[model samples]
Target: MREFCDSISSYVSKQLKFSNISIYQKLNVVMSNKVYDLQYKCQLDDNVLVVAVCYFTQYLQTQQINKISAALNVFSTCAVLASKYIDDDSFQSEFFSDKLQIESETLSQLEMHVCQALQYNFALEQNQLVNIQQQLDEILVNNSNTPKMSFLEE
Candidate 1:
């Protein structure tokens, strides 16, 4: 998992040249916080987080490297979509926008972009989910400095 993040960091740095390492660190912190907030506030299952990670990985695999803002938008949209996919009573875009502190219109646009990037396909095989969950577990275990949550725990 650490290797995955390191490779992504290296790729983004070499290809995008958008910002320094500190910016990526900050983005990780912010995204982590937002995912936690989404879970807590929406009472979403932790599978949402796992699925969001999968969606983000899929988005990265599909798209070219871009600016930090674009990357963040895609990530945020992934979380929103994951929640909606797993939770029938998921919150709407306005709710996500408020929780994420992003403008509603911007969030909507990003959501559309992510949906298109995904080619409207959101299915994940059981094995894929298991693999992603394992990677997420390793990431959480290795990064003890980050506040821990049992994302896959019942």
Candidate 2:
């Protein structure tokens, strides 16, 4: 999902005539804050949180420092959004409050800030899944045989 989100952000930045590397650099700066400490905070055992971090990094790449606080909110929202897709259960305000050691109301407010910063552009596509699935399908040739471990070994 993060790969997909990053791809979309890259496309948008190219469309906007901005430097993608600069956006990545700026994200690094914004993420140096305590609020961005969620990188090591989520309890999930999956890669969703990592993906959320990538999304946040890309989103931060495109935003200004004056918007960093709001961008962080959007990062949280994207994390929840990505969780909905990658995790089995949906994350709610209570879930965030319990997981991130914050209050439910505070999570709600942060979500609001994220929405405002993104202007609600939360429907970004994650094409990595589709691309990988398509490639696997082609290799399988619609046969019932399962794919080998070679793909994973790489």
Candidate 3:
């Protein structure tokens, strides 16, 4: 029954040229790309990606994501925190400001939002990381068919 309903919805969405992709799926793709870009641009350790994904997921659970902008902000904030927390590194604020077209100060504000949402605790146990890994795997499988959307255009 669920599959039938989804197929009907997919068909109607396609017929009307509406996006069938859910916001969460879009966020998943955008976040993965952002993490990859960070890895390439910052020469970051692989652990940073892991931490960022975990942090972003935790943030999502605590907050309601109603807009793409909010989702992106959380991702950027999580990425910055992950870099700082795991590598003792700072965000290349200028680079981010240029790319995100927001003031460097906005990053700080976003970071604070994420920190508060996460209760200011950044610690992660081995079991927590393992659980996060499983969650990520699930997201990957579920989002496999997510149609490509331009994050910038959203």
Give candidate 3's error at residue 82 in angstroms.
1.0
Indicate the residue-level lDDT of 136 in model 3.
43
Candidate 3 error regions (>4 Å): 1-29, 91-101, 135-154
lDDT of 3 by residue, 58-137 (tens): 77677766665666566667767887887655656676666655688988788788999999989988777666545444
Q: Number of the top candidate by lDDT?
A: 1
How many clashes show up in model 1? 0
RMSD of each: 5.2, 9.6, 10.5
Tens digits of per-residue lDDT for model 2, 1-154: 2232233333223322334667655654544332234434554422454345445545565555344344445656557656765666665668767766557787777666655655665454556434433443443433335442122121
TM-score of each: 0.74, 0.43, 0.64
Off by over 4 Å in 2: 1-42, 65-77, 126-154
lDDT of each: 0.67, 0.48, 0.58
- Best candidate, TM-score-wise? 1
Clashes of each: 0, 2, 0
Off by over 4 Å in 1: 1-20, 145-154
TM-score of 2: 0.43
Question: In model 1, what lDDT does residue 148 have?
Answer: 40
